[model samples]
Structures are given as structure tokens and as C-alpha cells.
Target: MITRETAGELLARIPVSVPDQPEGESPTAVKASPFTGAERRVMGILTVPKWQQGMDQGVLPRAYQDILDVVRDAPGPVRAKQIAPRIGLPAETSKIEGVRSKLKRLVERGWLDEGTPGLFTPSHAWTANSAKSP
Candidate 1:
């Protein structure tokens, strides 16, 4: 009978770590992805560059912009519960998941970054480009 609250607490106690290292690095040294060679090049390609069009105006329509606005203003990575109130949803419990779903879509499209597992932040690309706008 593990309620969500208890499960979350237990999960929090567990330490997070990557399984293995890249090449010659010591196990305890925290490889943490040096992003050497082609790895860096490929990752750069995958990331949406700030210069890409439409991002300044915000890529998607109203709701997506609403959610992005919340993330943009967050001082740090924020939990979904913290985001619900500002999402412009219909003030129903079910709206939380809807908000989460929109966030996921934004992540996929390179508009957001999942900075830590469930936590989110505006993608570097988005913030960088946003600064260039008037």
C-alpha cells in the first residue's frame, strides 16, 4: 500500500548515477560526458539553435506559449504541481496531466529542456534567442 507521497519520498532517497564510463576514465571520476570528438558535433546538430525562426515569437500557439511563459519565469527547475496554476487550464484536477503532456511535446520539439528527470527548464536555445529580440 504505497501511496504516491510515500513512493516519491522513497524514490528521492535513491542516488542517481550513470552506469559506465566512456573509455579510460576512472569509475569514480564522473565521466559526465566530456562530449569529445563526433559526440559534440552530433549533439550540436540535435540541439535546436537559437537562430532558428519562429522561436522568438514562440513556436506554437496560445497554450504552448502560456506554458513556456511559466517555465521562462521560473527561477529554477520547477515541478509540474508548481506549474499547474499558471497554465491557463480549466481549473480541474485533470488539467495537470494536460499541462505535463504539453511540456513533453515542447521538449520533443526542442523548445524545452528536461534538465533533471521530471524537472524542466527553458532550452538554452530558446533563452539565447529570446534575449536577441526587442
Candidate 2:
């Protein structure tokens, strides 16, 4: 997982500057996405970014790992909801929303694959341990 400090370091190298305000009267005020094509390419490589800060404080139980293990060996794409229960979270309002949150990050890191919406599957990059059981 990338740390906040790491994200800041990579972002600093880009030519663009971060602004203090989201919207301002000045024409030169920075926009959310001030980067050009080149910057986007660099940003893509940064997987965790500052969002990792949240995970550091979040609670992740062994069940979560089991869920990933289950999906890893699925014959085909799996749904996010299906994996949720395997981790002991069967609904969105479960106590451990962190499970859901980390799943999103995993998807972003290319450790898992996503489809139309709620569907997901393990990415090829996952090791055999992450695969499903027979």
C-alpha cells in the first residue's frame, strides 16, 4: 500500500500545482484535473495514493483474506456482493464497511477485475494462493 507521503512525492514531480481553493474567480485558478495527457499517464501508475491512510486505521479480519482467496480461484468473473458474504459481511450496512472499502482499492490496484457494476473477479496478477478452491 502506498503511503500519503509517497503519493505527495510523486504528485510533486508533475508540472502542475495544487491550488488552495476548489473554485475561485481568477481565470488561472487551478482545476481538479489540471494535468495534461502526460500527467495522467504518471498518475495511473500510482495505485494506493493518499487513500491508503484510511486503510492503515481500518479493521481487516482474517475473513477478508478468505474472501479474496475464494474469488481468486473462481472459474470466471465474480460479483463484489458474492465475495462480501464470504468475508462475513452480507450487506452494505455491515459493521465492517472497511471490507467493502478495501475491495474497491483492490480493484483499483488491478488485483481484481470489475465489470458493469457490482461484478468483480480476481485479476490474473493474483498469485495461486488468491485463487479459488476446487
- For each candidate in turn, the TM-score is 0.56, 0.40
Error of 1 at 77 (Å): 0.8
Find the 10 residues in a row with the least total lDDT in model 1. Answer: 35-44
Summarize candidate 2's per-residue lDDT along 5-51 as a digit string, tens digits: 79879889867655575555564755544222212134355324221
Q: Report the C-alpha displacement of residue 23, candidate 2, in angstroms.
A: 59
Judged by TM-score, which candidate is best? 1
RMSD per model, one decimal: 14.2, 14.2
Provide the overall lDDT of each model, using Cα atoms, as 2-decimal numbers. 0.68, 0.53
* Model 2: residues with Cα > 4 Å off, grouped in runs: 1-64, 90-92, 95-98, 127-134
Judge candidate 1 against the unseen true structure and give its global Cα lDDT, from 0 to 1: 0.68
